[model samples]
Target: MINNNSVTFIMAGRRQRRRRWLLVTGLLTALACILCCFMLLLGNTIYPVNEVLRALSGEQINGVSFAINTIRLPRMLTGLIAGFAFGIAGNTFQTMLRNPLASPDVIGITAGSSAAAVFCILILHTSGAIVSIASVIAGLITVLLIYIFSRGCTFSIGRLILIGIGIQAMLNALISYLLLVGAQQDIPAALRWLSGSLNGSQMDELPPLAITVLLFAPIVILLGKHLSMLELGEQSAISLGVNTDMTRITLIVSAVCMIALATATTGPIAFVAFLSGPIAKRLVGAGFSNALPAGLVGINLVLGADLIGQFAFDVRYPVGIITGILGAPYLIFLLIRMNRKGDL
Candidate 1:
């Protein structure tokens, strides 16, 4: 049972797994970079890569600077940061809850932000900074309430999800009410924002979102080791010397900050968070933590879908529309599977 060949074979297997994980992560990161570059270059007035770089380097190349640096660069950066945040935040929730359907978009956090932003837009006639501020506040309150209501004698993932669904339904109803009583002039803008376009993103508005991600993203990554242990269930995690409650709270707070900021910046980009984690896991396999991989997948999906929405069809659609079309089928399939298993 303790032969040298057996030991050598096990070592070799680990080495192979390490190599595969590295390869997958590297490839996904590279792909995201390529998509980001394409997002900058492939617009109405296409510029050469060198000119785009020149514009980025703060050189005043007239139209090129305005187009690339002013317009396209901000849009691309918005997509890049927001997509990564959604992906990482969504994956953290799904992995921590051990449920594929527990993303913020599905569970009402995004709904909370949407509802507040719609209210500010249609009713209060707010714009820019105030709307973003309102959405962040609403998102945090929604998640905190969800956590409070979902905690019973003992915490249950199933119960938390059920409660989140109910909250989502209520928020959707609120959004509908706000829409119905709104002025015609305000409704179209609200609808367009709800549809989640990066059309009018400004460089000035991105600092808060960028700052939030920069601060919390490292916390999430640093805790990635403990985060992976969460999937082993609370009792198991505790037995292994992990402080489950502290770990969960830390992660939930960090993730919510990123998710709220991202949503405020770009609205909910359909299912970027919902779809990225599983895809990353499939690509990277299971022996290692896939947080970074999942973020990369989110970046790729958002940027790629945006490109498709912009150029693939005769009429350009919002990025959310394309992602919604792609994610709907997957959602239906997942629902059917869960229903058959009596988990819905």
Candidate 2:
């Protein structure tokens, strides 16, 4: 009788979980649809929803097919990919470190990519694929360097964060130096790139990003299952038959690759990486979940931010700047709240 009661409780719990999952999934889907409509409606000349739908379906409306297909579509796609990448990557790292602030942007990866790309732009006269390559190299190298420097009896999150901040400071100085020495004509372009604009992303840049995310996101999601296991602490995970070292490394490498690819395309975007995971966790009612909700939330974040950037302000700003504007305060609030709770 007791065993039967336990089984009944388990079944009931599973049903509850399924219900919650469905509800969250439904909300996410609804948000995505709303964002898509907003994206179609918000740009200059403000197409009504009906006309935008027609244009998207390859039907002409207001002679705007060219503009919609060539310009708006690419921009919208870029936002979607960048946001999704940032969100998933951010959550992965945070979950790995078991800390909220442990995002790629916070940990020097983005700064590294930004620094290398800026240097290439200012000195090497590189553009396009070459710059993308440089960003990936810089990001990977920065993380590897951090790992090397921090290796001792074991890795410490505090050490990793401090080292990353140091790296960020160094990269920022280099950026300042480049701007000082750079020609006036190139300065504006460099600044725009640094500010993380989707202004110039062409459809050509889309394939690599799309393919990278498509190939790697599933791996990350699968690997993310080990996260809650890993979070039981390394020794505990090992005791539970989890290959802690391999799992950690693979998860980190996969996530870094996604971030590098995304950053290479869109210039490290801003807080999308840092913000997505927590938002998703809150939305999904926390505890321990993997990458799916975070990735979806990421898509929502970028799309929502881009729409606002394009239309919310009097003058257009890059999605990066808008995210920074929004994310920084939230980060500070998080920090303060953590401190108050003695988690800091």
Identify the candidate with maximal TM-score: 1
Q: Where does model 2 exceed 4 Å of error?
A: 48-54, 57-62, 286-288, 341-344
Candidate 1 per-residue lDDT over residues 1-344, each given as its tens digit: 56988999988988887798899999999999899889999989889989989889989997999998778888999999999999999999999999999999888988998898889889999877787788778988999999899999998888888899899999999999999999999998888888878888889989988998899888888888788899988888898889999999889888888888888788778999999988988998877888888888988988999999999999999999999999999999999999999988
lDDT of each: 0.89, 0.81
lDDT per residue (tens digit) for residues 101-178 in model 2: 889998888888888888888888777778777887888899888888877797887778778878888888988999
- Predicted candidate 2, C-alpha RMSD: 2.1
Going through the candidates in the order shown, the clash numbers are: 0, 0
TM-score of each: 0.95, 0.92
Model 2 vs. true fold: TM? 0.92
List the pairs of residues colliding in candidate 1.
none
